[model samples]
Structures are given as C-alpha cells and as structure tokens.
Target: MTALATAPTARPRPARAWRAVMRLHRPALIFWGFFVSVVSAVLLWAYGPGGNAAAAAWQRPCTVDLCDVGYAVDIYHLAYRFCEALITFLPVLVAVWAGGLLIGRELENGTAELAWSQSVSPARWLATKLAVPAALLTAGTTLLVLLHRLLFDAHQVPKGWNWSDNGTFEANGPIAVAFPLLALALGALSGLIAGRALPGLIAGILATATASTLIGLAGPHLVPWKTSVGDLKEGYAAPSGVIYGREGAVTSTGAHIPDPCTGAGKACPAAHDIVGYYSEYHPSSQFWALQLTQTALILTVAALATAAAFTLLRRRTS
Candidate 1:
C-alpha cells in the first residue's frame, strides 16, 4: 500500500529547442543553401568547362575584317563560374534569415510572453534556437568551399578572385567568413527587435548585402598585387612573342596609345590599364609586404565589427 502510494514519478524530458527551430525555418534554410548548391552545380555543368561538349562552339581565324577575337574558351564558363561563386555568400544569408526569423516573429506576435512564462530562460531558448540553423550553415559553407575548390581545380579556372573585382581575393578574409554570420546574428536580433519574421529576414538580407558590398568594394586594395604591368619593362616581351609590357592605371590622357600586349600583326601600344588582370608575375619583385599588410588590415576590420556585435548582444537591453 505504501509502495503504491509513494510511487516515484519519472522526470519530464527537456524538449530539444533546436528541433522546433529546425521545423520552423527548414524551408528558408534549404532554399538558401541546398537549392543554391544544386542550381550552381547544374549551371556549372551545363555552361561551365566541365561540360564543354554541351557548350561547344566552332571557332576559327576571323576571315571578315573586324570579326570577333581568336578561338578561345567560351565566355559562358566565366559567367557560370561567377554564378557558382555565389555559394560563398549563401551561408551568411541563410544564417541571418534562419537565426532571426522565429525569435522576432514570436516577439511581434506576443508568443514570446508565453515562452517566457514557461521554464525556458531567454538566453537558453535563444541558444537552442540558433544552434540547428547554425550547424546547417556551417555544413553548407564547408561543403560549398570544398566543392568549389575541387571543381575549380578540375576546370583549371581561376578559383579565387575578389568578388568585387577590386583586384584582390577575400577567400581567406574575415569579411567573407563573417558576412553571413553577421547577417544571421543580425536577423536573430531583428527577430527579437523587429517584432516579425518577414521584417527580420529582410533586415538580415539588407544588412548582409550592404556589408558584402563594402567588402567587395574594399577588396582591390586588400590583397597583394599578383604583379603589376607597371612592374614590367617598358617593351618586355615573352620569348618568341612580340607582346610587350602592359600599361597600368596611369593617369595618362586616353588618346589611344599602341597595344603593347598585342602581337606583331595585331594592334600594338594600346593604352589601357592591364594591371592586376592576368595571373602573371613581373620582374624586380618585392611587393609581397604591401599585399600581406592590406589583407591583415581588411580582415581585422571585419573581425572587429563582428566582435562589437557580439559584445552588444551580451549587454542588458532596456
């Protein structure tokens, strides 16, 4: 009788907060990450160097006066290659949208009061909610970067370049790494502050886009010069070739100079800034320090911005 009366009750299991988060934002997450991956792969395969047979074009010496340039790789490969490169930014976008969606939506809807009334602490609830999406973003980023590196290597395409074409690569910079994370963090905060999911997500995307533009704009001065045309001799030419040194971003009058990079029968001394375009090195080398320092500075700015955001998050809000 006593055993029956005093039967112990089993403790209720703690609900996995991440499960709810995943259920809520699964569509957006998938759309941003996996969808991008699949589309990128298809685009690359169909129009990229990987499937040249699919994108083949007949090319021969131009018989007509003022015909197109020589037979070379199709421009589609370059275009598709840039499209696939968008993968690098997907993680940040997904992160911002997913992280900020629910929290803000709930707050806007007044559902968060019910949650607060329950046993969950705001920080713990937030952490659990952010975890699942963050894991997915991390996974997406790793897979995308790896796949890109492998595919670019296979295709012999220029794998890394400043997305902004600012003459530097941000593949190793904190801006590239932090951009999406900043978006997610901002989105999550927006969810809390913006009071609705749609607003939060939009805010996340806007903030990320703005930051990306800044990074891209700043990329040209951020990396080492992969050899400048000005660094080359005035009439330098490769062996058995009549091509000479290219003119750089000199502030000379645009009175149409000869094309130095041209061949004997082709145009010569064409006055144009051919600096930082080719993947070639020049003589009298000694520009490594400038590039390295620039990279460090830009990356430092990115890191500091992220740190400031986190620091503010840790503070008590009114």
Candidate 2:
C-alpha cells in the first residue's frame, strides 16, 4: 500500500507532431507517391524497351522529301517529352499541395489552432509540416533528375533538347530539386498571408508562377555570359554548338551597335557599322557552374521565405 501510494505516474509522451502532419496530409502524400512511382516506371521504360524501338526507328531511312529533318515520333521521344513535362511542372504541383492541401486547409478549418492548443508550438508545428514535405520533395526530384540525365546521356536527344535547353537544364540538375523547394516555401508564405483555402491556393499558384517568370527572365544575366566576336561577312555561329542567348552587332573598335534593317541586305550590313556580331552565350562546359549558381540562389530565396513564415506564425500566435 505504501509503495502504490508513493509510486510516480509516467508522464504522457509529447505529441508526435510530424506524424500528425503526415496524417493531416495523407491524401497529398499518397498522390505524390503515386506520381513518383509512375514517373520512375516511365523513365525506366525509356531506358530499356523504348530505347530499342527508337534506335530501330532512327535507322530506317526516310524516302520522303522531309528525310531526317524530323525524326519519327517513336516511343523514346514520347518518353523524353513525358519526362521533360513531368520535371518542369513538378514545382506547380508542389505549390498546389503546399498551399491548398497542407497549410491552407488546416488554417481554414481551424485545425492549426487546435493543434497549437494541444501542446504544440506554432513554429514547431509549421517546421514539421515544411520539413517532412521538403525532404520527400527533394528525394523525389533528385531521383527523377538522375534518371533523366541517364536517359539523355544514353541516347540521341532531339536537336533543341540538349543541356542548353531550358527544360533539359532544369530537369537534368539540382535546379529540379531547388525549384520545387522554392515553390513550397512560396506556397507556405502565400498560405500564411491569405489565411483561407481558396485564396491561399490561388495566391500560392500565382506566387510560384511569378517566381518562375522572374527566374526565367533573370537567369541568363546571373552567369558569366560569353560574348563571341566574329566577322559580319563570315556570319557568327556558336563555337560550342549551344547558343541560348542574345546576339547583336559590334564594330571593329568593340563598340556596341544595333542593326536597323530587318532583312539580310547590303543596307542592313552598312546601316549600323556592323563589322561583326557578338553572341552572348553559356557554353556547354558552364552547365554545372550555372546550375550550381542558380541552385544556391533558389535555396537562398527558399530560406528567406521559410524564415518569413516562422516570423508570420510567431506574430499571429502571439
């Protein structure tokens, strides 16, 4: 009797906040898992059976006038396009999930408040929410990027689908992982600002879209753009075979010039004193450099957004 009376009760364990987060967003998790599985299967098919079919189709000479100008729409090409679109649009999907299905729904339905009331700090709750999904997103995107690079290296890519291509560059490197994280961070910030489901969803999508547009516009300037000066009469062609940048005329004295004429005529050549042209481009050798630089910038933006989110949560909770 004395032992029973003096015995201490075991304290209840702290709530498993991460597990609660997973439970709250189980549907989104399921969808993401299904999507990753399907994409992995498609990529594997591209590397295996589809590759053989595409190779066979490429060997057949074209009898028509078009000839090799256009390759046949083979299974491999289809798979390649599928991978491109999948990696490219992944960020948007992340935005939607983070906004509507994660925080938006919780905030709208008062579940966030309820969770905070039940022994969970707002910051910790939000951190768990962001951290789990971010880990999964990073893993999924990195796997897809690796598979994409493998497939691209093993076969002949379409003329415009090289490393210099926008979709190709994004899908083949760390940018694939970084961009989704940026979208997720932006989505969370949007959700906190809007505080309602539909509005938050819309805001998140728009925010992601805006970030993408800004990046597209500003990306070229971020890296060291190589300017190749060549004879105007000889015409300028990229030495590296990849030219994803602007071209304009330059004088013998290295002064910048603008061409007034549109068509290729004698007047067009003489109008701007165009002795030569400068082609600003990123060479194939700079692929990894540009990718790493862009990734760092994107991650920085993500970090800022995440910090802002915590601050916002703190203010609201306080």
My TM-score estimates for the predictions, one after another, are 0.58, 0.91
Q: Could you give candidate 1's per-residue lDDT for residues 212-240 as a string of tens digits?
A: 66655554444433433332244322222
Q: Please report, as a residue range, the 10-residue window in candidate 1 with the lowest summed lDDT.
A: 236-245
Number of the top-ranking candidate, with lDDT as the measure: 2
Estimate candidate 2's alpha-carbon lDDT, on a 0 to 1 scale: 0.82
| Local accuracy by lDDT, each model | 0.49, 0.82
- Please, what are the lDDT tens digits per residue for candidate 2 over residues 1-318? 456456688999975877877787888889889988988888888888777666667666788665562343455777888888988999998898788768887899999998899898899889998999999999988899989888888875344356777688889899999999999999998889888878888888998899888876777678888877778666665576564678777776788666454477777666666687777788888888888888888888889989999999999999
Candidate 1's C-alpha runs over 4 A off are 1-6, 36-49, 52-79, 88-92, 95-100, 156-177, 219-318
Q: What's the true lDDT of residue 155 in model 1? A: 50
- Model 1, residue 304: distance off in Å is 6.2
Candidate 1 local Cα displacement, residue 90, angstroms: 2.4
